[model samples]
Target: MDRKKAAILALSLLTIISTDTVAPLVKQISASYPQVSSTMVKLTITLPSLLMIFFGLIAGQLVKVISKKAILAIGLVLYSIGGIAAGWSESFPGHLILRGLVGAGTGLISPIITSLIADYYQGKERADMVGYTFAISHFAAVITPPLAAYLGAEDWRKAFIIFSIVPLVFLFTMIFLPGTARRVQSDAAEKRKAPIPTKAIQFALIALVMMIIFFIVITDLPYLIETKTGISPIVSAFGLSTCTLGATIAGLTFSQIYVRLKKWAIPTSLLACGLGFLLITFSGTSVLILGGLLCIGMGIGILISLIMLVTANSAGEADSTAAVALVNGGFSIGIFISPFFYANLPRIELGLPAVEFNFLLAGVLFAAAGVIALLVAISTNKQLNLPHR
Candidate 1:
C-alpha cells in the first residue's frame, strides 16, 4: 500500500488510542482529586463519549458540506490542544472540560474512517481492509495501557502528553489524505439513498451491549483489584493490556474466522467474552483474571469489526457514513452510561464478593446476548434457504 492509504488507516488506530489515553491514569487522577466522586473520575475516560455521540452524527452530515480531509485536519488540532491542556488544569472539573474537547475532535474524525474506506475500496478488498483496521486498532490497545501506566507512574499529568502525537498525525493527514472527497460527495449524492437495513441496527444494539460489558471491566478494574485483591494499579494495567493482546490476535485472524464461521463469527466472539467474564467472577489468582480479560478482548475485537462492516454495507454509498456514525454513536452511548448502569444493578444475594458479583451479573448478560445472536443467525440462515414463490 502507498503512504496515503497507510496514513488513512493510521487515523483509525489513532482514534482508539486517543480515547483511552487517560484510562490508565484514571485511578491516579481520582486519588489526586479525592473531592470528586469515583463516577466523576471515570468520566475522564467516558465523558468524551457524550460529545463523540453528538459530533459523530454531525460529522456525517458535514461530509456533504466539507471535505473529510479538512474535518479530519481540524479535529486533529483540537484533539492535540485538548489533550495537552487537560494536564495543565488545576481543577478536576477543568480537566474534564478539556477531555470533552478531545472527544469533540474524536467525534469529527471517527465517522470519516469508515466513510473514507468505503470511498476508496470495495468488495473483498473492502472486507479485508475492515478486518485489518480492527487488527491495527487493537494492536494500539495492546500497547497504550502499559505505556500510559508507565507515564502515569511518574505523574498522571505526563500521561496526557501522549496526545502530542496528534499533531504528527495531523501533518501526515493534511499532506497525504486525498482532496477528492468533494467529487466523491457529488457522486454519492447522485445515488439514491437507501434505507439502512434493520440488521445493521440489530448488530449495533448487540455491539452496544458488548461495549457496556467491556467498559464495565475496564472502568472498575483498578478499584476492583485494589479493593478485592490488594493489587497495584499497575497490575490491573497489565491485565487490561493482556485483554488487548487477545483482541489483537482476534483482529489479525478475523477474516479467516469470518470465512469459516460466516454468520456464526459474531456470536462465537460474544460467547468467548461471556465465558471470560464468568471465569473472572471466580478468579482466585491474577492469572485467572488475565485469562478472562483476554477472552473479553478477543470477543470485543471481532464484534467491533463485524458491526462496522455490517453498517457500512447495509447503507448506500451516500448513507454509509451516517450509518456508521449512528452505530459508533451507540457504542459511545454505552461507554458514557456504563458506570451508572453497573452502579444501579441490584446486588445478587449470592455469597460472591462485590466485584465478583458484578462480574457474574455481566457474564450472564453477555452469555445471554451470545445465545440470542446465535438464534438470530440460525433463523436468518433458514429464511435465506427457503424457496421464494
Candidate 2:
C-alpha cells in the first residue's frame, strides 16, 4: 500500500508485459511476413528470453557500480521504446531486433526487482513482498494476453501497444523509489563477503526446471485447446488466462501457505502441478482443460516464489542480487528452450498425439520431481535435527 511497495508492484506488472503480450500475435505476425521462416517468427516470443539471460547477468554486475533505481529507469526506457517500436516495424529482422532490446530491458529490470525486495524487506515481510510480486505479475499476465489477443485480432502490430504502459511504471519508479548509492566494496569488505551459497545455486537449477514445466502451459496450451476441442483461438487464449488466474490466486495466498507448509512447500507445489497436468492429460472438455491449467498455474506460482525467497535468504546482501539473477537467468533459459525441447520429444515413437503426449510427459516429470523434493526435504530435516512439519 505504501509508495515503495506500490512502485515495486508496478514494476512487477511489467516483468511479463514485454514477452507475453506478443505471444498471441505470433501467428498473425508470421502470416504477415510470408518470406520469413516460422522458426524466425517464433523468435518474436523467445528472443527476448534468450537476451534476458545475457543482460540479466550484466544487470547483476551493474548493481555493484550504479544505483538500482537508475538501472531500473534505463531498463524501463529501453523496454518502452523497443516494445512500442517493434509494433510499427515493417521488416521481420527489424522487429526481432526491437524485441531483443525489450528482452535486454527486462533482463535488467527482473533481477533488480527481486534484489530490491531483498534489500528493502526482511524475514516474513520479505516473503510476503515476494508473494505480492508474483501475485501482481500473474495478475498482469492474466489481463494482458487476452487484451492483446483482442487488439491483435485485426492487426498483430496493435498488440505491441500493450508495452505503452511501460511509461506509467517508469513514472512510478522515478517518483516513488528512493535512490541508493553504488555498492562499492573495499578489498577487505570484499574478502569478508561469503561465497554465494550452494543452496542458492541448487534452487536456481530448480527454478530452471520449474519454468520448463510451467512454460508447457504457456507455450502449448492454446494449441492443445484449439486442436483438441476445435475452439476459437480466443477461447484458447482465455483458457491460457485461467492458468495465470490460478497463479494469481496462489500468489495472493502464498504467505499463509508458506506459514503452514514451511520446507514442505516445494514438494507440495510440485505435486499440485503434477495433478493439474494429469487432469489436462485425461480431461476431454475445454472447461476441464482450463481447470487443469488453473491448478498447474497455482503450483508453479508458489514454486517460483519459494525459490526466490529461499535463494535470497541463502546469500549475504552483497551477493543477493547476483544470486537472484542466476535464478532469473535460469528462468529465461528455460523459457527460451521449452518450445524446442517439447517439440523435439520422441512423441511419434511413443504413438501419441503431440499435445496429449506433452501433457502426459509433463505430468510424469512433475510427479517424479515432487517425490525427489520430498526426499531432499526429509534428508535436510534430518541433517538439521529439525522437526518435520
What tens digits encode model 2's per-residue C-alpha lDDT throughout 1-389? Answer: 77888889999998886777777777788899999976567788888988988888888777767778888988998899998999999999999999999999999999898888877787778888889999999899899989999998999888888888898889978999878623334563672355767887787787777777667776666556655654445457687678888888999888888888877888888988998899877777767677788888899988888788777777754657778888888898888887888877765567667887898889999999999989999888532211211
Candidate 2 C-alpha error for residue 169, in Å: 0.9
Q: What residue pairs clash in candidate 2, if any at all? A: none
> Lowest lDDT 10-mer window, candidate 2?
380-389
- How much does candidate 1 score in TM-score? 0.92
- Please list the C-alpha lDDT of all candidates, in the order they appear: 0.77, 0.81
List model 1 lDDT by residue over 203-292, tens digit each.
Answer: 668667667767877777765676556444445768777877887787777767767777788689889989988877776677777888
Give candidate 1 misplaced runs (Cα > 4 Å).
182-197, 227-235, 376-389
Whole-model alpha-carbon lDDT for candidate 2: 0.81
What lDDT, from 0 to 1, does candidate 1 have? 0.77
lDDT of 2 at 387: 20
- State residue 254's C-alpha deviation in candidate 2, in Å: 1.1
Native-to-model Cα distance after best TM-score fit, residue 339 in candidate 2, in Å: 1.2
